[model samples]
Target: MTFQSTTSGIWIPLITPFKAGELDESSLRRLVKHYSSIGLRGFVLAATTGEGQTLDDAELERLASVCADETSHCSCEMPIYLGVSGSDPRKVEKRFQQTKHWPIDGYLISGPNYLRPSQDGVKRHYEFLAGSTERPIMIYNIPYRTGVNVLNETMLELAALPNIVGLKDCCGSPEQSYDLLRCAPKDFSVLTGEDPFFYNAMVHGAKGAILTGAHVLAHVHLEICEDLHNGHQKLALEKWNRVVHIPRLLFVEPSPAPVKHWLWRQGLIDSPEVRLPMLPIGDSLAGKIDAAVNLQGGTDWRI
Candidate 1:
């Protein structure tokens, strides 16, 4: 169940399915089952798009366990990266200790959110966590949510670590992302966490992406990456142009809300329920997604 940066491509930070205020294990399992058939590089459980902040440890583990079970049945194994974030390094260390034996192949950890530590502090935070566990780590550099960007220099320093293999980059600065991508070591993969930036990142030699919008139009996303790899730039741009608006549309509301509604509308998930503080997509957005979904050819994505 080992995973490395070389094979990283189009990882989906799955939307956590919920039913009646409880973890919807049934829908969760079904989602994994369907995605396993897709040509995705991997799955990220309980990530930002998965509403990781709202999930308890037990709920999160169920996510990993179910995904693990479903992937085990597939001919090709799908690597599962569990998402965990904290404001303190020591607390993050404790999280490593807790999920150290989960079914996941590795971890996707975010920087100290809300606390907004200094660059040195942030570096030391990941330094401790990377050394805390033997499993590979994908540093989630989503400064907008975490409130502290991991600068390219600091990221390069972290990339030197053996376990810190890649980044879920959402630094919100194209210049910064390009700088890091150019400076990053060949082995240090850079996967954009910004859904709308996927094409730009790929064009900039990003290893891939951990996209939420990928929950819908996933095969199209996969194809765009393939086109880049196969040197079909023209084809890639054409495909990207056609669906580039989907990412922004999904975020018209607040993230996984629109994404969940899209999936629910497609019958990929039973419900589009997000936890408190994150509500379901409003009717207006739902209508837009519904029309877009129909325009995308009425589900049957797995058929």
Candidate 2:
């Protein structure tokens, strides 16, 4: 079959479920099914939320294998996209060169972070990366972390490339996003990378989102997307409001750290372990996260 995204609703930026400083394949299996049972569409393995920056090629491959195996067998027919990128174009190129042979459905590549390439450079970077791989590409633009913005003009230019199929727009600007939606060709999907804008993105014509917050509330989030597509606008808005603060909550203490805390409490993984420079949520933040979780009716709020 030709490569296509089955991503629309609740495509979890899945947390890397580890234990005893090793890959927990069992937890990976259980996690996929847990979301699948809740009607989540797919898995975004090894993305930023999965700590892609810290994972080696072998580890990514193993996680991809587990996700693919589990997703294919699950009732949801979920597709898995492997996220890969770095500040160095050459380093990211090397990664694309290395993993081009893997079985993932596609690659979700972010703009070069820190170095902050110019607009033309960003386009060229994606051009070269897409040229290097057979996998379809989804350009990720999250300026908050990346320090570079893939403006709508650049996005339109990149959309013309055959292999460049979609974008993860986290530039955090609704005006730019709406303009892209108005101008972008239908097949060139515009998926939001901003978790808070999930419902609005869908309502305003975004195809979908790549959300880290969905890891805990995948079912509800996916239902919101489905509700909009099915013309249930009121219902979609209501569902969207239910956890809009989730992005802020999960992001308050650096990504994946807060998310890890929630997952650990749910018995989905072991200790809420994060790599160096990213420690566990402190007591104050923990209390805040707990309150947010409780407010959202999430029973898994311990830290």
Candidate 3:
């Protein structure tokens, strides 16, 4: 399927589940089934939320294939997008070529991290990768993480490429986001990666979001998008006000830690175990997540 068709809606950046220090295939399958049943438009496997950096190529490919198979069997047949990143253009290109046979619909490729390449270099890097893949590519512009931002001018230039279909806009600059939203081609989608800014971004013309926080209260986030699409401005703002604290709570201890804890509590996964360098949520945050879930009317509070 084309990227434009999958760009506009709530896309979950799935968390990698581990059991006894290995990929939890059962939990991963169950998670995909649950989310796909809930009206999610697509899935982004092994992204930052999925701990892509910590996973080996084989693990990443396995994760993608599992998600793709599960999604295809679901009632919705959701598209699965893989997340890939690297500092060396040659290595990144080669990796993409090697993984070309993986069962995925597209890729969410981030800019090089640490190297902090110039705009021209960033453009060249993306262009070279785009040239290597037949599948659609979504530019992941999270400057805070990558240490380099894909400026609006560079974004527009990339948008002109036939296969560079959209962006996961976590640039962290409202000015840059708004400019790209206004100037990007209609087919060049702009989906927010910032959970806190999901509502605001959609209101300002972002097609959708790839929020990690949605792993808990997903329907509430999906409803926010639905409300805006149906032109319920007042209702959308009200919903946004009610659930805006979710992102803060989820990020209180750094990503999927808090999210994984919540999912485990909901009986969606077996354990909340994350890899080394990333710890599980603490007791205090666990209480907060519990209270948050309760306040939202418990697990039954879904659309």
Candidate 4:
């Protein structure tokens, strides 16, 4: 699909569920079904929120397959985008080759992490990958996590590529984001990856967001987007007021831990299990999440 048509709205960076130290296919399917029913525009499987680094290649394949299969059964088929990131150009290219036939609509690839390449190298990195894959690519420019930022000039250059459709803008610089938004091609989308900045980004003309916090109270996020799209700035801000603390609360610890705990409390997943090097939520935070859920009236919150 072209980026112009499919890149907007709230896309959930899914959390991979684990049971007994194995991929929890059942819970994965359930989470997809629940979100699909609530009207999420797309899914980003095995992304950072899903603990992509912790998953082996085969596990990533399974995660993609389960999401694709389940989403197909939804009343509205939501697009699925698989997340792939690394510092090695060859290895990253091989990832595209490996998952080339997987059931997915596109790819969410991040800037090279750790080794922090120059802006020119980063541009070449995506140029090489874009040449390697026929699928549309959403450039993920998360400097905080990847240790390098895709400067506005580099981003505009990458946006010119036919296959490089949009961006998951986490560059962490409002000035850079504004410059790109002002100059990016009309067809090239710029979706914010920073959860706390979702509403702010929308006001600044972000197409949408790939939010980890949207895993809970997703419809509220969707409504905020709709209000903005319809020019209901007042209504959107009012809606945002109700859930602005979500991202802050969810990220109070390390990510998916707090999110998974919230999902477990809502019984959306069987267990709040994360892989090694990532643990479950703490008791204090769990209590806060519980209080949040209670205040929102749990899963019965109006969609």
TM accuracy, model 1: 0.96
Summarize candidate 3's per-residue lDDT along 184-245 as a digit string, tens digits.
Answer: 89999899999898888989999888899878768888888888889998998998898788
What are the per-residue Cα lDDT tens digits for candidate 2 across 172-291? Answer: 889999899899987787888787777778889987777888877677777877788789999888877766777787888788899988777666666778776667898987888777
Model 1: which residue pairs collide?
Answer: none
Higher-lDDT candidate of 2 and 4? 4
The TM-score between candidate 2 and the true structure equals: 0.90
Whichever of 1 and 2 has more TM-score, that candidate is: 1
Selected candidate, larger lDDT, 1 vs 4: 4
lDDT of 1 at 158: 95
Give the distance in Å from residue 299's predicted Cα in candidate 1 to where it truly belongs. 2.5
Candidate 1 lDDT over residue span 30-134, tens digit each: 888888888888898888898898988898888888889988998766888888888877888888888878898888998889987889999999999888999
Q: Count the backbone clashes (under 3 Å) in each candidate.
A: 0, 0, 0, 0
Name the runs in model 3 displaced over 4 angstroms.
300-303
Off by over 4 Å in 1: 5-7, 300-303
Q: Which stretches of candidate 4 lie over 4 Å from their true place?
A: 300-303
Candidate number achieving the greatest lDDT relative to the actual structure: 4
lDDT of candidate model 3 versus the reference: 0.87
lDDT scores of the candidates, listed in order: 0.87, 0.78, 0.87, 0.88
